[model samples]
Target: MDPAAEGTTTISPQLAERAERSDLHTLGIEEEYLLVDAVEPRAVETVDEVIDQVPEQMRASVQHEYLRSQIEVASPPQLELSSLYDSMRVLRTTLADAAGRAGSRLVAVGVGPASGPNSRLVDNPRYHRMRERFGDLSPGQGSCGTHVHVSIPDDETGVQVLNHLRVWLPTLQAATANSPVFGGHETGYASWRSVMWERWPTVGPTPYLQSHEQYLTMIADLQASGAMLDEGMLYWYARLSASYPTVEIRMGDVMPTLDDAMLLAALARGLVATLVQEVHAGAVAPDVPHPLLMAAHWRAAKDGLEGTGIDLATREPRPAWRLLRQLVDYVRPELERHGDAELVTVLIDRLRTRGTGAARQRALLAKGTPVAGVVDWLARTTRGEM
Candidate 1:
């Protein structure tokens, strides 16, 4: 039932061999998107209706999100980046078509472009309890984000992967930061979705941990402290997935296009693959100070790729683009091993040349387009029509 299997593209045999070996580390992606009115371009509570319209064969891949106005679609894990990319593209196109049939547009971004209700809570007991516990911090519907999951061999290795993945987060955040406009105007911060998302008690960077046992201990402590209602609400920027044997990185806003999402997916898989090797080689995870790491996260969220960020290595401000390039270099061998170095390089160049999602949204707004028009643009671009 893998959609990517339907339209397989032929490739060089040498790259094909690498891609075959790359299956050891699979890639999975989940994205949350607002269901907005096609004309008014405001959040609409039609996720249920939209999901209902999904093709019967693809129903397993689509579901409701935290908000009633939000829907989520996950591409099945793929052993190869090309397959993962193809499946995701099909999923977006299919889900978007379903939304169109339901009279709403599925917008892929961090949050809605316009203001919405204080809460559009989905009708579920767990969701209700969360609302009771967090109140206004819980959006009835919530901001959108792209969650990338790369398979790890085991839990212990997953913990180590999280550690290695930490230093690269700020760069990833800057690379994918998309939410710039909210309430119909500029929010000043590059990723307003991330800014607003941090209002919740559990969301943000994860603390460096020693082992898988420690990872569980921390979660149990958070649950006992009332910061988390359940394991499902861990909400760390990156964590070991509870439902799957994968390291889930949820730091970035939902990228507006298939190519953008694939960039993150490829890098994530490469990072996980590289880190797993180090794990076996008995390499120590870099222990960055928590406060400094928090500051780095803040800078990336505030400025995105266009702005300078704190270089954790030297403890100095450097262009986010430079950090991103260094990250690519750090994982180049793994990218090559996965047969994705070329594609990843091309995507990185395209992203840099066009600017991050936040920059793109700000650019349109600067031209005096109404927020509604921005919403229209979001819809079109998300549908890959732009």
Candidate 2:
């Protein structure tokens, strides 16, 4: 019998069982950092050397990125927000110390502030193939980001969450906007990395999917198209994980501080949990138009939190903070369920008062600080020394 016709769906038994056992709002975080010359403060091709110095226990968690100057560290799935924060702090401190010992510094900025002609590709076959295929578009691909994964029951629920969560992704991007300066020039857009990243054909808001079968079919179609290299290259802002039973939110820039990264994770978890509960309660996913969603994403990328964001529901302009508050209210129940309500509130308040990382960088520049000073500040802030 057809699984869909039987109302059982196409989920594998293993996936269904794992989903049943999964803890809602369980978190996993992946952050990419750029290695820069300690004194000169420019992106340097030293990830290979720095990875060798990582502790043996963390070797598996730390991995190379597409660029030679970049390293990405991932945390095991975490159940508590505080534990996730602690794990990230340890990883950042360890990686920074290792990079410092190797005469480099790890900067968590979204894009390399001083990336120049010297940046090189990581010596990997896949990266080589990408460069060969993409040509000029592949050389200057050193942008970094923070990916947040929230556990869900199964692919069916995951697809539903993805559809419901699409409208709020722009708000998340605005909250974590950090990449203002790239290649030593003010890019005008707050998160310049967002602009750079969307150059890939598949890296944007996904279409509203009706089922797990539809999601898989879409991936299959994209892979069949020569535009995509593989299923792994489905770099949508949010998607069901290819290797894990979680919905991965990939819209935010690499936040400069551990606090910012944790804030993003908390919000992501809350959003996913809220959506799952709604699905259980028979709420249909919002049928928002794709172009409007893409426009919202573009507005968020261009303005960040400094300006207006497209209100997905109204399809009208609104203050970024106002939209952000709407998101918080929408997910407040989930936040409370996870004991993260107060923490998220406090973090959002702090972000408003201190401004985002991009705003902070602009403030330094406004005070007549050089680009190098901005880079130095980012390095110190990322290391928790500032």
Q: lDDT winner among the candidates?
A: 2
Model 2 lDDT tens row, 227-316: 677777788899988777789898899988887888899999999999988888989878898889888988988888889999988889
Every candidate's CA RMSD: 4.8, 5.7
Q: What is the model-wide C-alpha lDDT for candidate 2?
A: 0.84
Taking the tens digit of each residue's C-alpha lDDT, what string does model 1 give over 1-386?
Answer: 01111111222456435545755677788888888887896788998899889998988788777778888888877777898888888889999999999999989878777876643777777677877888878453458888888878789989988888788888899888998887766888888888888887888888888999999999899989999877888888998877766798888999788889999999888888899999989998788998898899889989999999988888999988989999899999999977899999899989988898889888988888888888898899889898
Off by over 4 Å in 1: 1-23
TM for every model, in the order presented, reads 0.93, 0.93
Error of 1 at 327 (Å): 0.3
Candidate 2's displacement at residue 263, Å, is 0.7
Candidate 2 segments exceeding 4 Å error = 1-23
Note the Cα lDDT for every prediction shown: 0.82, 0.84
